[model samples]
Target: MSLPYTTWKIGEVEHKLRLTTRQAVAVEEKLGVNLLKVFMPRQDEDFPLPPLKVMLVVIHGALQKFEHGVTLDDVYDMHDDYVDAGGDQTSLLTDVIIPLFENSGFMPRQKETTDDQATLTTVK
Candidate 1:
């Protein structure tokens, strides 16, 4: 099976972002909050987008797995490069960040049912 990862391009470099269990724990420690909780807001509060630092931390965490010795500063620079290349923060969040978590299995995936399975009749 293919490994779970999200591809992010900054300038000429393509980064594979994957959050393994260890990386996820490290990210949570750095953020001082549960990784999942970062995306979840209090029931009484409106859902707020994560701060830039949180995004960078997550990106760095995912990147460090494959790109050894990579630093958070490198991630910041990558973000700048991405923006300079016409990638906006909104698109980055929607396209990269969200997909990263989804691909990492932190978020529930949509179950795909084939036509044969979809046509199954229930027995009483």
Candidate 2:
């Protein structure tokens, strides 16, 4: 199932988001496949450590975006996957994943707290 918009909350803060105009057009052009990330510029990552942690955060954020929500158990499951894969648990989530999402038009809502998750009702 897919939601046009997905509301993500952090503590008392909430983020209401939908695909941006550009993103919408891109999605339409792709015919429904999520724009995937193939390469990352952060080659400086501690290969033996950082990539795994970063991958976890990316997965977590992806679940939130696509699934519209996720529970602690979900995070735990991801964390387990990381551990099982022999990844380091000390990597920085923001440093690892946020840049890519931001560059791709996925961003946290400006207000960070609003029960409003609506897609672009009208494309620009």
Candidate 3:
């Protein structure tokens, strides 16, 4: 079966990011951290941001399926150019990382509810 993936544009090139079971295992082994925990939600205000190296490694792993011959250095360079073009970490998180995992079936997609639905829930 084909794994789900999402597309991210760095500069003029569009790269496909996918996280297969094998690739996810590889990434976890390389980082020595369970990806499920790494991607977990936290409530603490002081919760630490994911390390830059971890982000790069995940990005590299995701890129391996479609971006043959790509390396960690290449991902770093793309990230540098992305920052130079005014992309920030927040944007990267929302645009690339979140969607990458969500679309890859690693994270659950948040459901949207209307005001009436919210009111019904509150009134229950």
lDDT of 2 by residue, 23-108 (tens): 44544354333333323234665333334533444444444444557654666665665456554444324432344345345554
Model 2 ranges with Cα > 4 A deviation: 1-62, 90-95, 104-124
For each candidate in turn, the TM-score is 0.80, 0.29, 0.77
In candidate 1, which residue ranges exceed 4 Å CA deviation? 1-3, 42-47, 111-124
Lowest lDDT sum, 10 consecutive residues, model 3, at 39-48
lDDT of 2: 0.44
Compare the candidates by TM-score and give the number of the best one: 1
Give the C-alpha miss distance for residue 73 in model 2, angstroms: 1.7
Ranking, TM-score, top scorer first: 1, 3, 2
Pairs with backbone N, CA or C atoms under 3 Å apart (clashes), candidate 1: none
Better of 1 and 2 by TM-score: 1
Model 1 — which ten-residue stretch has the worst lDDT?
A: 115-124
Quote model 2's TM-score: 0.29
- Per-model root-mean-square deviation over C-alphas: 3.6, 15.9, 4.4
